[model samples]
Target: MATDVRVHLVDDNTPFRDSTAWLLETAGFEVHAYPSGPAFLAEWPSRRRGDGAECVVSDIRMPEMSGLQLQDTLRRQGCNVPLVFVTAHGDVPLAVEAMRKGASNFLEKPFSDDALLDSIRNAVAGARARGDGAVDSEVLAKLSPRERQVLDLVVASKPNKVIADILGISIKTVELHRANMMAKLGVRSLPELMKVALGHG
Candidate 1:
């Protein structure tokens, strides 16, 4: 966990917001609480400072503006802050949508303080990794065009035989290209390769 992490907690419920903020502060984090999405956006410039906040914990359901809507708005505005959704048990579909839209994680309500903290820690690590400049265009350009295609397929979770079929190459050739791309990108894991291909972390 990052000792200097700053978190923004957005929820209409005052008690939940306050208690969660207090808990995070006690855990050595700097926390800001907002009553609504608009309120947070209104004060965002001031809240987003030099180092940037590590993560945002927001409720999935709210009046006027839903958490998913807020996530979309942030993406439209090019804000790359990792978002963690706090939702009710029945909101799993919404949580899944949020994840597909790049949310770091989702916590069903009635969750423990430890669970929230662990999720926030993971979000912070993801944000740091994304901003590390480990997957720049220069690094990507090192691969040949065929290698890039194979890499893209690999990052898309395609199997070696599938990639070979798609690219009209042999399975052994696909494996060789995959290895070459991984070596050139200095990525050792499928997730890391996906992050590089997706321009995330």
Candidate 2:
């Protein structure tokens, strides 16, 4: 019943998506459904918020891209949104692959609504814990003087150009430092990085 819990539902089956979305919504979750992995990816960037999605429920097999592919794509793009795989009876192996790639849980087809809701709750809890731990890692604590300066500028809501000018460095150099900071902190977006720097996550 948490208002902060938003779930993204990705599956190629229109009927499945609609039914699942309805169930989640009835259970008080904010749900968004996508017909395919590609469609989800297309909207993911613009849908991102400072806190990221609470959970992603996706099918393992689909047109365009499999659920594993979608998970990998999200990771590569620096989106650490918690993923949950929904698979058919015969897709357990694929679900395992999804788990190895950072999925929080896998719900087999024909699962009850209660089972699905419980899995999602667990995934959301895990995501919150991981996110908080990441924000406290030594990598974030051990920023270099320049990286700290760049991060401070970033948290100040300054553009790269402004940061470069203020720090008397080239814009490229500023960008490099910012990238390094992002990598060290395991954050993928400017807002996430800023949240870390501001100690709000």
Candidate 3:
């Protein structure tokens, strides 16, 4: 089906923005490329509601507002468009912070177009499945920090013992968290748990 999957792309580099937009469009996405985060914010409705924006692909370092700042602003404004951060100067700490803040994905610059497309696809699918982020928040709020950690490891296909070793907890504790996560997410099977862990409703 031809869905209205619009991607809001922001980057200070004009050439890169244009090229990325072209790539996204060629891959069957509708793209609106902006010169900076401020430019996007200027055009985006202040009272934005619902899940209209399919996703965002933005450069992490810009003069007007950094991508991290943009993500924060979007959250504050309740614009729950899924975010993908792309930066030339990406580091592990930066990527980790972005994900910790609920960014859909972070890609280093010079990434393959295929990878970028895959992220866009995943982000859009997750947005549709997530439906405005309220349900996701409600579901996640049910988990403790340790349970959330166990859920992540479970989604990575780790066995309970390996998850215990990684989290420095006992195997019984790992099992408990995994079971709690599954029950909270209302899924009885591992694949269903994985789907919930990935933010699919």
Candidate 4:
């Protein structure tokens, strides 16, 4: 239940941070809002460790100590609090790298309320099941041969048109294959797909 989750919300933008905190709190999550990554890190050790699921939801871009850098710092300190990055469309590649480094999930900016809630829930659950950003062989085996082919090209960063041309298929067919591949792999983003393909941490 939402009430069983605790979210540490970090973003440089005060309005966005407060609004997101309010949204999460409204959804029944216990939220602690931070204006910067440093602020969160400074209080991380002192923060209450609740009995239920706990995670950090942070914006990828910040003027002082970006989210990725914060994530790295946490990792170096052996902190495994699950991290869910919030990123703009242009910062997706950075978010992908965060996944490879063991972030639990990331939401694109302008994401829906349910999208954020679902991401936080899934991040906590997935972390408990297999640690963050993990893709196992069993999950990989779910893809069909065609889906696997699409997965490979997609992980290679090929656009739909290029993938279609390379695979001798129509663009729509490539899109179908790509969609199916991601579904079968249980990955929502290209960076997640690449994390699976590249065998990241």
User: Who is ahead in TM-score, 2 or 4?
Assistant: 4
Put down candidate 4 lDDT per residue, 52-132, tens digits, no spaces.
378899999999999999999988987787788999999977876776576766778999998788778766654544443
lDDT of 3 by residue, 1-201 (tens): 114688889999999989888888888887788998888998777423355447888888888888889999989987778788886753535654666677777777788998788777767655665564534777899999988777755653447865665667899988888888888889999878756765554
lDDT of 1 at 142: 98
Record all residue pairs in model 2 with backbone atoms less than 3 Å apart, i.e. clashing: none
Top TM-score model: 3
**Cα lDDT tens digits for candidate 1, 31-139:** 8899999999898878785354478999999996999999999999989898889999998678767765777777788999988987787677546654664457688
Give me the overall lDDT of model 3: 0.75
Prediction 2 TM-score vs. true: 0.65
Preferred candidate (lDDT higher): 3 or 4:
4
TM-score of each: 0.67, 0.65, 0.69, 0.66
Give the Cα lDDT of each candidate.
Answer: 0.80, 0.77, 0.75, 0.78
**What does candidate 4 score in Cα RMSD to the true structure?**
7.9
Query: Could you list the CA RMSD of all candidates, in the order they appear?
Result: 7.4, 13.8, 5.4, 7.9
All candidates in order of TM-score, best leading: 3, 1, 4, 2
Candidate 1, after superposition: displacement of residue 61 in Å? 0.2
Model 2 worst lDDT run, 10 consecutive residues: 126-135
